[model samples]
Target: MEFWTGLYLMSFLNMACCLPKSSYTVYLNKLSFSTAQSHCLPGSFLANIPKEEEMAEILKTIWDKNDKTATSFWIGLQKNKGDCYRKDLPLKGFYWTVDSSTQSDVKLWETEPSNTCLELRCGLLSVKYGETAATCNGFVETTCRQEHPFICKRNATVTCRRPDILGTHDIIDYSNDKDTCYVHCASGANFTLKCSKDLVWTVLGNQNMDTSQLCLECNKGYRRDASGYCVDVNECEESKPCTHRCLNTDGSYKCACSDNDMDDCDGSKPPTTDLTRNDYSNVNRGKSLLTQPTSLPDDVRTNETDVHIEESVGDVSNIIVPVIIALLIFIVLLVIVAAIVKGCIRRRTTKLSRRKAEAVALNGSNSMEKVNEKEET
Candidate 1:
């Protein structure tokens, strides 16, 4: 079934789970550097000062509780005494035995030692003073000399003896402090089991309790469903958790840049600039159309009708202005044609009249010439 349809049903479902804190062990034994190194074997090493403030604070507490004398136990630091041909300095050779690391950032020192001194080599921890150099063969007096006691730091260990169910593969986690509460054991291909704080091994999908338990959300990017199973939550549908688009993964969601065309990420209604004309296609116009009353009184109807009439009149004027222009152009063409025709007729008439007058004058001159000839005879 779709998860969204069941969202209302499981609206009160618990989402948070509890986790256990990491465990640490401290051993207080008086021994030489080599003896102390062997003492913290199999599981732990000499206490290596941690970088975290909380861990440092814990070590300080342990130190405060046990510190009664000037010389305390040796920590992870051991003296690096090399032969005469050794090119490396004494401080350079010094390293942590825990992981063979030479990283030394946070150092508690009573008085900083000068590398010029060859005898003082191994690291020693004093209750009131802090970390300082001491001789390996016990030479320096009143400070850190002779064989002294030391502290060893080890991580609390947890082991799963057997699988909660038969034919199931077990996944173990002893690394994280927060992940100490539950262990993941897979049944079949998809389903998993979680061991809760109550020491009860409950299979996922078997609903006997309502309270949240660690590893219930077994997968990292998934959420627990009503069936008490871990499932991916489609964050894009309900919460709209992304700036642009939300992509759901195993137990987490990722955001992406929005597509082009419009800058709005939520895919909301597009913007409108001209509001004078009613466009019912948009949300704003639809709201305006819905909010107004359907029926109107006689006077209101009259006013609306008058407004429509005015609009119609304006439309008519817009159409009439172009038609009038076309008609004026046609009339001017006709007048120009008529004037050209009249001018041609007037020129033809004048030419015909001139030709007739010339013919009559020629005929009268011929008759006069005939009379003159008869008188001469």
Candidate 2:
């Protein structure tokens, strides 16, 4: 009896561990690749056969289905936009739709009827020689617009199915070990779920707990209303984060300053200068102040230095204006003095010449008188 119980336990454990990781479902309904993908949404996705064994398994599954109309079935392999062909590489730039990181098995491609990646192409497994009775070979490239029967794949583990209690807005995340599923709602509420070995989902330590009680927390910039839905929180009315004017946005608030109070509205002080404070004593200060170490911040020091430079330029201009005026006055006075001295010299030379001429005439008159007296005697 003990041996029989041990054998039964071992068989159960072996069956549990040997369970397939995924399962495939073939849909004979002809549909485009996009439509087929859409049909597989919410839980499953397009089939991905990454290994030769998996491809063989899928082909065997298709053969077992015995669909007389399906000549080819769409797979998850597709050449996305901007993906060109590479003659040296396997799969020729095609990627699996479910997990692009998994490379397609190189042996799962046929050699005949070679195809090129000239356009957006999707992949499908074709029946050899177009015979429905024939087994499917490797995949072949075809346009995505072509209608064909498709295969969808989903996780086949004994784990619980993903819950949909939180509606379409809920995001589900799995742990690295894939033992725990975390459901996060847009309303900022979070719920924890675990799959037991018995194929049951336990929600927050209870198997049949009310999900409405899980949505208690609110997200940032949102608040729960009376209807239990998350609504936008008016930060302008509630928090008043703005200094001057507060404008409410969808999930945030904008702060604005008036034209006159443009400075310091964003919680930063305005740039200041000595001239703005009407302190002229430091107008002639030298660069020594800059060379010396100070306790002021770098930005403050930079602003003060720039202001000092501007004020120094203005002071230099003030001194230059007076100097220019004084030079002009001195030049005008020098010219007038030169002109007066030239006029006086000209007058003195004229008077000296007239006196000499007068002396000469008087001497001639006296000589004439002496001559007349001699003639009379």
Best by TM-score: 2
Question: Model 2: per-residue lDDT, tens digit, 200-273?
Answer: 55565666654444455556777654334567999878877765566677766666554244333344222332
**CA RMSD for every model?**
22.7, 18.4
Candidate 2, residue 120: the lDDT equals: 83
Candidate 2 least-lDDT 10 residues = 268-277
Off by over 4 Å in 2: 1-20, 111-118, 129-134, 157-377
Clashes (candidate 1): 6
Report the C-alpha lDDT of model 1 over 1-377, residue by residue, as the tens digit: 67876885565443212223333344455676777677766445666654544335545555555544534557776544441212243224455667767555454455444344345456665544345322122212122245676666543343323334333344554454322333333422333444333334444556363323432335555665544456786766767776555566555566544433333322232222212223212323345534663543333434445556767889999999999999999999999999999999999989866755665577787755665565468
List per-prediction Cα lDDT, in the order shown. 0.50, 0.68
